[model samples]
Target: MSLAERPDLMTTDPVTWDGGMGSVGDYIALLKPRVMSLVIFTAFVGMMLAPGSIHPVLAAVALLCIAIGAGASGALNMWYDADIDRVMSRTAKRPIPAGKITPSEALAFGMTLSVGSVVLLGLLVNWFAGAFLAFTIFFYAVVYTMWLKRSTPQNIVIGGAAGAFPPMIGWAAVTGGVSLESFILFLIIFMWTPPHFWALALFKSGDYRAAGIPMLPVVAGEDATRTQILLYSLVLVPIAVSPWFLGFAGVTYGIASAVLGAGFLGLALQVYRLRTGEAARKAAVRLFSYSILYLFLLFALLLGESLVTRMI
Candidate 1:
């Protein structure tokens, strides 16, 4: 249904959060700490790959700022989507919907982190990196969570850019600007996102429908989503191996990328061919699970290559 036909689908009634003090754990939940780990790892890889060395303390601070910025975006997303979250079984336990934290409090907390992260990064690292972090938070919180998610089925396709910026941001922290290598890192994540996310969307179509989200599977149906996933996976396989061609990675990374990319493509193909049932869910889940490992192993190979080179 078009939003115009069902305005209530996207609109939420006002919710008031009592200023009741929650535990530290509750506050951490508001930050979506698990999600922060991915940002930290990718950003760390980017920093390690940059051409020059930053002081250890400064590097630590930069990573901290990045984590906090990512957390702030998560908080803002929870705040804005609390209503939809309450209806969806998957997200119903999140801090906001569970009443562990108030939307107003989350807003204040996110804003504080967002500003603090950018300013501290600028003061301690460089203005360019700080600006980049600020933009990343804004793009994720405002652009993706607020604008794109409910508005279009292509939400993950475009919104994935917000998540892709971390490596570039990390590179900027060291080199003071984006380099082609860092962008390749960014592109890998950007392209991997659709296939990764769509796989989940396939299995979680019910949760999305309940929340009125326009996830690819929800909006376009299963077969279309499977085709799109296959198409993205095919394109992504080459991009995953491109770092080796671009000369930033070594034979170890090249070999790993080739193997992992093939696994990724094969899983995506499995998803495309399966019919709806336990078999279909198994394929989609397998693809989704392997996609995470694919990204981590690919980046880890680059990191390992760098370490061995330094020793040599």
Candidate 2:
């Protein structure tokens, strides 16, 4: 049966079919928890690196707000992008596209979570954080999902700012304002996004092409995308070291940043050098996988250095 004919399939409660069964977990999968985990981790790192300390309970509350906001963004994105998503292989099985969740329900869920997270953060934590969280929702759901994704080749470039906001929000939760330090954190993620996503685009061009999305690989072609990746990776190395130059981090972070930056550039260069379809795809996948590790390790090192300096 077509998706619209079986509205009952979208409900969260258990459904017994000719095949087997489904439950609440399907709806949770719709929220994109794996993506939320990364949001929480980066925000946590930002909070930790911020100048002041938040109480443990308050910190937990802040993190919860961030997670809820991230999930809200994801839900709304799914709601709006369902049509295109159904056409794309990578996204065809998502809850909305799979007919496991209705667009209206996802919209309601996202709206409720967005409002709840912002209000709770304002009441329990701080308004600056609340405001940032609210903006993040709007930027992702409206700016990126509704407008940018369908319109521009630079969609990921501009849309990346939405993902880059969590660290600043986390910093604001503790400090009640933005600062150069938080901005450096922001810049790091911003610069890192193009290379990371373009790597994925290189290997997944078919999915993007099917969705009619103008990703770098679709518009600029593989060779140009590879060149852009190399250029962006080169620029990122210096930006990654800016935390040390700006005095937000110590020499340890500077050293780690240099090493990580070199590793990232090396991968990008490999991707550029290996121009054959199979080799490029392998390099792209390797770079995509390593990029996640690279960001997490960069932040972890920063947090560790902060802790050690405090102890000393």
Candidate 3:
């Protein structure tokens, strides 16, 4: 892109480059593999917790499909967001924005994977899971990326549902439908997303402003964003511990959830109470960093609980 097209990425006049010499790794980056890790983990937890038996081979197939479908969603998101991504420092080096992959190539790659994953999943596993996976890709690519992202300050708030669906899909893969158990898993992620992302948005308000994406921090101001974060964190604490209370998990999980939920609330409070200077930034960063670990550990406890129960 020329200087006019993307001064954020290009220091000089626009010059055409052949979208870089993409390697296997570059293509993988287009799939947002880092983001997929959480999705894959939560899906596995769902599959493990679900009440049913899937053949080992078929179980692997289900996971592969979930991973591929999630990757396709990421690829499509990158394709659609390339313009804004080029301007955001955090995303400026993504495959599309970095010119390692062309938009058309990304779109084609995403579409092909989307169709293949859904079709194979339906045939190999169950139609319910397959349909859910297809809807996830569509919701992320079209509903969230294309529509909600640029149009609303609550984009992440709603777009988070797309991320929340994977675990439910995994549960469906084994059980052939969703259950209350699967839905609580979904809710944990759903409630967690706003506070998690708003923390990053708090630290990166300039990026959203430059990209013209109306994130809560950009549209609602820092005070409002911080308040929302604390409120969400408060709500998330009880939900995080509910699996244990509801009898799907053990006392070990109850303790873990209680501790992690407390930490999450504490961090949110730090972000809310402390404003201005490096202290505020640090609070946001701490919350963002810990939020990821909090989710992983919460799910890990459930997976461990399930395994121990089966063994005993």
Candidate 4:
């Protein structure tokens, strides 16, 4: 049947299809749990690195709110992006695009969670964090997904600030305000975003082209994209080490940042040098994979050093 005639196929009853229980996994999938994990981790690291201590229960509530906020953003993003997602091969299997969840339902779910998270955080935690959470949702749903993604080649560059807000939110949860230290964490993620995303964009150029999304590789040539990726990586190296120079972090994080920064630059160079074929694809994938590892390791080291200092 044609797509137009398959209304039943397009509409999803998530409740009926999964026999009511819905499995723990499908619900988790709705939250974009993998991304949520990163949100939780980075936010936790930010909290740990910030001055002062929070009660464990308060900490738990703050993290829960952050996770819900992240999920809410993802659901809204999925809801809005579902159209292009249906067309893109990589995103076609997502819950909304696959008809496992309807767009309206996803939108409602996201809105509910968004409001609930902000309210609970404001009441149980602090308004500073709650405000940040609310802004994050607005930024991701309205600013990034709705406006920026379709409008410019610098979409990721600008939209990245939304993702970078998690650490600041977490820091606010602890200190009730933003600081240069928190912004340092934010800066690291911000600087890392373009290279990280462009690496994926390099290989997914076809999917983006088919979806009519003007990613770097689609608007600019692959060669230009590669050069931009290398340049961003070069800029990120020093910024990643800035926390150490500023005394928010120690020599341990500084050394680790320098090493990882060099490794990231090496990968970007590889991506630049590789020929435009399967080899280039492999290099892009490798950079994408390592980029995640690099960010996680950098934050993990920061958390570890903070813990060691606390113990000492």
Task: Give Cα distance to truth, residue 101, candidate 4, Å.
Answer: 1.1
Best by lDDT: 3
Per-residue error for 153 in candidate 4, Å, reads: 0.9
Candidate lDDT scores, in order, read 0.92, 0.89, 0.93, 0.91
Candidate 3 shows a clash count of 1
What is the model-wide C-alpha lDDT for candidate 2? 0.89
Model 2, span 200-262: residue lDDT tens: 999999999988999989998999999999999998889889988888789988998999899
Between candidates 1 and 3, name the one with more favorable lDDT: 3
The digit string of per-residue lDDT tens for model 4 on 210-266 reads 998989999988999999999999999999999999998899899989999889999
Choose 1 or 2, whichever is better by lDDT. 1
TM-score of 3: 0.93
Q: Write the per-residue lDDT of candidate 3 for residues 1-312, one digit (tens) a residue.
A: 566797567566676778546789988998889888888888999999999788989989999999999999999999999999999999999988887788998998999999999999999999999999999999999999999999999999999999999889989999999889999999999999999999999999999999999999888899999999999999999999999889999999999899999999999999999999999999999999999999999999999999999899
Answer with 2 or 3, whichever has the higher TM-score: 3
TM-score for every candidate vs. truth?
A: 0.94, 0.91, 0.93, 0.92
For model 2, give the 10-residue run with minimal summed lDDT: 15-24
